[model samples]
Target: MELTYLRTFREVAKWGSFTRAAEALGYAQSSITTQIQKLEESYGAVLVERFGRGMKLTIAGEALLQYANDIYRLHEESKEVVSKQSKGTLSIGTIETLAAFFLPPKLQAYRRDYPDVNVVIQPGNEPFIIDSVKEGALDVGIILDPPFSDPELHVNILREETMAIIASPDHRLGELSEVRVEDLESESLIMTEDGCTYRAMLLKVLKGNQVNYNLSYEFGNLEAIKQCVIYGLGIALLPRITVAEEIRKGQIVAVPFVHPECKFYTQLIYSKKKWQSKAFLGFVELIGGINHQNH
Candidate 1:
């Protein structure tokens, strides 16, 4: 069996979807399926079983997955050892919000110090980025709100962000200095999809207040949600840092909650067992130093 097939199987098992594995590896779905099939045939055992729209590993598959993880780790370590003798590259993952608002300057500094080091930036949502880091797909991930229950990872708090209610300038809530949760009962709301940290906080707050508001839409893309709110589709709750420029430009109005305040913490997360390259260490230092200096 090819080592590549084992790597593919590991990725598929980690994500629990052939389609997702294909996308992550930049392979066609058919190619991923064929690779897994060949691996199974060679072993004379089925590794995965279909479960709803996704797949779940059989008992044998789970055992192989454990071994696969260790093999992949050793593979990465070997590559790092050789690369250090020559040169090295850093693979960093970040959420869209940080990629847009915060990462550019840090990246510039990183490139300046290590002109020969290749830097790869993978952008995705919080969960995707975190999962990639946990699975050894990324060297490090800049994420918003640390994962709830992962003891194998280390998280360094980067910044604190406030959550605010946003609306177009002409919306009824826009004219208010502060609005109670009850006042939002009749307002149309646009929210991020489930699994988003902000979405969970917003729902908890609304539920706590016994507020029954109208939810018009749910989206995962920040820009799409912003555009919808800009066009007066509905009000939205999001991080203050994300809407700072829009609020300043008078494109949107940000209002504080009268009874409850919501906040989010941004963090730099990485696996505790993963080796941190010199380039990754430099970038982390740059971010930490700059934030400290400013404070």
Candidate 2:
């Protein structure tokens, strides 16, 4: 079996979808399928089976996955050992909010400490970030609370971030110290796109309380949402860390949420199965130091 086939199989199994594996690996979907077929042919056993729109690994596939991870980890370790004196680049992923506010200073510190090491940052939503980490496309991921649990991953809770309802300084709700869910029944809301943990939490609260409000707009970017609120387009519910500077500048006011569930944690996640390089370890330590100083 070619090593490339094993790599393709690993990505497909990690993502549980051939298309996702193709996208991550920058290969055609047919190429991914062909590689898996070759692997099955080489082993003379069915490795993957498709059911409905999703796919699952068969018993043989599951057994091989462990070996594949071991092989890949060993390969990475060998490279790291040879280059032990000079750790190379580290790829990191994070959500938009943290990318804008939380990561700059921490990343600055990391760059200052490791001037020779290169760093690449990719911004994505929680699911994409977690999957990228699991697939080994990213060395580390910083995300808001992941939606599901995976045994193959390690999660570190960096901090608990509280959500707030933000609006222009002169908006009707801006003067309130706190707003009940019912108070927003008729108000216009600007929200991030689906798959955001905080957005899901806010929706659950509104639905549970039977609050019917206007969703005036949905934005995929946090900065756009903030700008919309700054011009009095509509109020938004976002992590306080993201809007702190705006709140401090008096451009926006963060009204407290009476519902207690408006809080979630930020996490640093990585694959337990992947090899952790010296550069990765040092970068994680840098983030820890940043969090410590913040506290």
Candidate 3:
């Protein structure tokens, strides 16, 4: 069996549509259909069936998918090992918060230590980064806590981050060094969008305490939210790492919540089945070493 055929089949099985698989693989749709047809002929068995508008795997297809996954994983592992012997490249994905605050120095050290290896960083939100790694679009990801639940992915705890309720120096709550849930009842809250884990946790805590406050605004970007808060638009609860400079410059005041301190774990996430290359392993080790030094 041709390896290309198996690869195409794997893509189809992952996405459930030839069109989607072709798009993801950057192959023509006709090429994807041809590959599947050729594979079916070689196996002398029907592997896929059309269910409604989408494709469903037959028992034979399902069985083949399992083997295909294993084969692809092994092939990738072999490639990584071989390429690393020649000193190749590594790809890493990370969310914006880490990209901005935590990863720069580590990445700088990585580049200095492994001048022969190329490291690429792709930054996005947690969900986007996790999906990219699972789909083989990226080698690894650094994500914020409340880790992704995909069984195919592996997660390693990197560090824990503390969140603080912050406001402009002139804001009403800025004078207080520490605040309770009840103290926030009269203030408008600015937060990230619904998909943000930190935002969800903050809301859950507030709801549990029967604390009601107006949601002044929601933003996807932390910088924008910080700007809004800096201008006294509303109070925002955000990671301390993200707002440390502002606090130091006296632009904002950070007030820790008294009960149920808000904390998030940072994790390193990657496809469980991926072959760990030398460069990839080195990057992981670098991150681990940095965390150890910090502690």
Candidate 4:
């Protein structure tokens, strides 16, 4: 029945380990166990259960968690409205490229306008970002992806960002003004993580053309990918904005490689069910200016 107990339960569910939840909440592991026990007593059902190496929610635990999420959301909303603090944390989840290149200016201005509000930036994959928003784990998200929509979240398109092929300035493919799919036959390729939208697009195009290629390198970090391309390890496909400065500095070249599927956009998203606090709206407005300017 206590709010803190529900919070502890949520944390336990989030971490899936009593020890981890305790560490994250700055409590003793025994305290975490006590809280989970208290929650089960209040609800009259067993909650979490062991799942191999970790823990998972029991059927009753899953049922309570859904309501727990709503309760937490509503309590935060009540605190914001009743107390009028004008202060809260805005947790934003974004992919690495947008975190580095697209959001800095907008987030800077957002901070200036809402000096009391704290911002937490979580760099992660697109699906994780979307899932976090839906779960009320993140206040908002910025991502570079193709036209996206979810019944649980509101999607706002920032702008269309063209995909480009990047390679060392002296790579053989750079000699051509435009690099066609066939032109890359048997060529080495540096790639981003497997599920990356741009990486998937590149592979789909090549497969459609039946162009055999080599996966010379696969990297989870953008800097590593760029460095590999710079060293002539292989050519890579990525959003153009990510390599604009490198191309300008002559560290890399953006080869023209256009495909319909390669066309993606920067987008802002938030859960439709979430209560928009004043700080949240302020941040959205700042990002809106970027959306307007880019049009």
Candidate 5:
């Protein structure tokens, strides 16, 4: 019956782990259990059930969750209208490149402007980020990807990131201003792990050209790939933004790979239906504003 109990229930449902939900909300695990118990009692139904190591909502819990979602959304909107509070959380799901290279300055500026806001950056692959945004778990999703669309999401292409095939400065391909698909014939390729969007793009370009290349190594991390290239392990395909500083320092050379297929953009995405708080809208505009200022 209490609004705080509803808030606690929502967090519990989101995490599915009393321990984790408590940590996220700064509550004790016992406190989380008590609140959920009260919430279930109010509805005269067991809302959550033990499932293996964690817990999940029962049929009743799932039904209650839908109404809880509506309640919280309206509650948040009402609070914003009454208090004009710009001090809530903004959770962003992003890929490795943006987290490490692109977002530092933008985040720093946002924090300075809205010191009361709590910003959370969650790093994951594109599919995970996309799903999180759609589920209302993440406030926004950012990626360096080719043009994308989802009927449920509002996708905005912030800017085009120049793609490049990077190699050690002293490598054989360094002299070339641009590397063509055929240029990589029989070359050793250090690749990102499967499920990477750009990896798929690069492989498509090579397979379409019938270029035979060796996969010397595969890494899921950006820095590891960069380190391998710096040591002359092999050439890699990555966004120029990821390697710009190394290129400037003469550790790596951006062999400026160009192809119509490999072009990717900085994107900002959010659910079309997700309630956008003032802080949420402010962070969104601040990202777009950075794009304009940079251009």
Candidate 6:
């Protein structure tokens, strides 16, 4: 079967619409239909069935999708191996904290060593990054510890991270050696947006202990949250790595929160079934080197 036809079929299966698949693949709608027809004729089986305006995968289609993923993955791998040089884009998805603080030095190292490899970093929260990695839109993802696990994903625990309640030096909480969730109930808080993994974890723990607090400000940007905390607007529970520089500069005091659940993790996530290119493997190796030095 033609690789082009299989690719078109995968896209159509993904979106459940031939028009959408055509639009995504930059093909005419007629081309998509013709490719699928040719593929079906070659295989002598119906791969997709139409119900009204949408399409659903038949058993054959479902099976083909599995093979299609493997076929495309190996095709890319073959190209990378034959090229013998890293000259393609590496798409990475991550949360803001890592993008802002942790990844810079590692990224700098990567750029210096592999100047020809283009790197693109997309920053978002855990769910967005995880979904993008699973969908093959991103080659890899750095995500906060998620509440649940997916068997299809290969997750490497980069580190167990410490999260603390931070405030400007003169803030009331700064005087305390350790703080409690109950103590935060009466305080205004600066935090990441609602769906953030760390935010959700903290909220879940607080709810379990019946500790309620006000979200004075919500920011998707870690720097903005840090700035708000530094200006004494409100206290924030943030990863220690993100605020290490500020703490060292005496701009903020990171008071360790007293809770078992305050511990978080950073993970490197990728699809288990996806074939890894040499450049992708190189990046993963770089990450390992960085992690080793950090510890």
Give per-model TM-scores. 0.78, 0.76, 0.77, 0.95, 0.86, 0.76
**Native-to-model Cα distance after best TM-score fit, residue 133 in candidate 5, in Å:** 1.7
Better of 1 and 4 by lDDT: 4
Supply the global lDDT for candidate 2: 0.84
Assess the local accuracy of residue 106 in candidate 5 as a C-alpha lDDT between 0 and 100: 93
lDDT of 4 by residue, 26-121 (tens): 999999899888888888899999998888999999998898999999999999999876698999999989989998998888878899998999
RMSD of each: 4.5, 4.8, 4.4, 2.6, 3.5, 4.6
At residue 282, give the lDDT of candidate 3: 78
lDDT of each: 0.80, 0.84, 0.81, 0.87, 0.87, 0.84
lDDT of 2 by residue, 122-204 (tens): 98888899888886778889988733457877777788777778999998888788877888988899999998888898889
Candidate 5 lDDT for residue 61: 92
Give the Å shift of residue 7 in candidate 2. Answer: 5.1
Top candidate by TM-score? 4
lDDT of 6 at 262: 67
Q: Enumerate clash totals for all models, in the order shown.
A: 0, 0, 0, 0, 0, 0
Q: Local error of candidate 2 at 136, Å?
A: 3.2
Q: Can you list the residue pairs that collide in candidate 4? A: none
lDDT of 5 by residue, 63-162 (tens): 9877887787778778877888898888999988899989999999899988999899999989999988886778899987889999998888889888
